[model samples]
Target: MTGCKVVAIGGSAGSIPVVAELLQALPANFQFTVIIILHRLKNVSSSMDTILAGKRSGIMIAEPDDKEVIEGNRVYLAPQNYHLLIEADKTISLDYSEPVHYSRPSIDVTFESVAQAYADKAVAVLLSGANPDGADGLLAIVSQGGMAIVQDPATAEYPAMPQAAIDRNRDVVILTPETIASFLHTLND
Candidate 1:
């Protein structure tokens, strides 16, 4: 429960089911805080937090305020039109920086920030997505001595995001959704 203090997960086009499954598989006492960034429309209001929270996974899921404290056993989603950042104090901050990779709440931005904030205590996962947004960030996480995981491209609805991360960071652990869930289950051990 103490090895990894934070988990950052990002995805796009085809990640919802995987995310749901992963969350469902986690126990109520799961040890780390989770931060998620999924590419979304700049103008639309996102119901992602509500939708995910309703899953009854025993984890609280919500969009965080600009300077909210990061807590364990909860999931925080990046708000639409804002990029979520991990402050040095281990709190969250939302930024309106111009979209990276043509998407707000870019995986790259969140991953990079957490890589620096939590360093080796961080774990990053790049799931199914249509673009290459998370590859560089995953690499950054690894460069900072954090763990990186990617969905196997063959199992992804959109292979680009996972594949990009694989291409950039060869050391990434790649697995199917079910297997990924099982792997995450071991994090606290």
Candidate 2:
């Protein structure tokens, strides 16, 4: 889809490596704002943003402070223990509400919010995870006329997440990690 403004990616369990691979493949000048929501442990400190930043192929990466304005050529990660939300004004909001699917920073919350915020100008990607957290969220994006991409179950470290999304929306584009990056690059062009 042309005029895409934001790409929301959600995952858990074995998704980190897949996320790294995808980020590494994106060109330095990629123009869409990227938001990532990964299930993480509560009360535990993680340097995930630093780790992902290390793999950056020119895109900036960081965990956004609440109310930060969304920007392109950057990747924003949802902090652990907070639900990440996209505001209609193109800013990020952090919520400490009850967890969804037994996890805070629920993929469903972020994806659904992005669907509402960006609508047809959004892209949602569902990746590897041990649970079914992201399936409904991917469907939400599709319902809003946004593009949905699900990692191929065969290539996932834990297939439940991607499989769940596929089960929910069979029409979503299914691709391996490498191909997902290639497809995203086309969107930039």
Candidate 3:
């Protein structure tokens, strides 16, 4: 999948550390676009974009803006208090809405949009999270012929997200933090 269109990674609560480890494993000029949808507080400001940017060498990290173009080598996070949906053209849609799984920037919404936007050219990965929000969406991606991966539920600090994906889908890669990074590096290769 050298020409894969996008890689969508999602997480929550325990996302900070998992995301850091994952980003460190990818090359700076990674071949595919990386979009992240981590649960965030609606009222509080998130430093995730800046923080991920600082930790990763070549991955440009920023919050998604409405109609913004998606590009490779950059990581886009859904902003707080909004659903970050995507267009068929790979542009972004940021909508302020009620929370799902009690999260404003819900992972399922992002995955669902990407499943539609990128179709078979997408990859969806779910990490540690406190809720099962991304499970259904991850399955949607798989149904659309996209690859789906989940962190090992047993190893995840919070396993709801990973476990949910497991229950909903089969043959999903379940990996540890370090191994997850290595796998991503290999996949992006």
Among these predictions, the greatest lDDT belongs to 2
Candidate 3 worst ten-residue window by lDDT: 180-189
What TM-score do all the candidates reach, one by one? 0.96, 0.96, 0.94
Q: What lDDT, from 0 to 1, does candidate 3 have?
A: 0.84
Report the lDDT tens digits of candidate 1 across residue range 90-127: 88889998989898888999999999998899999899
- Model 1 clash pairs are none
Task: Name every residue pair that clashes in candidate 3.
Answer: none
Clash total of candidate 1? 0
Off by over 4 Å in 2: none
Worst 10 residues of 2 by lDDT: 53-62
- For model 2, how does the per-residue alpha-carbon lDDT over 42-91 read when each residue is reduced to its tens digit? 98889999899887645678899999999888899999899999999999
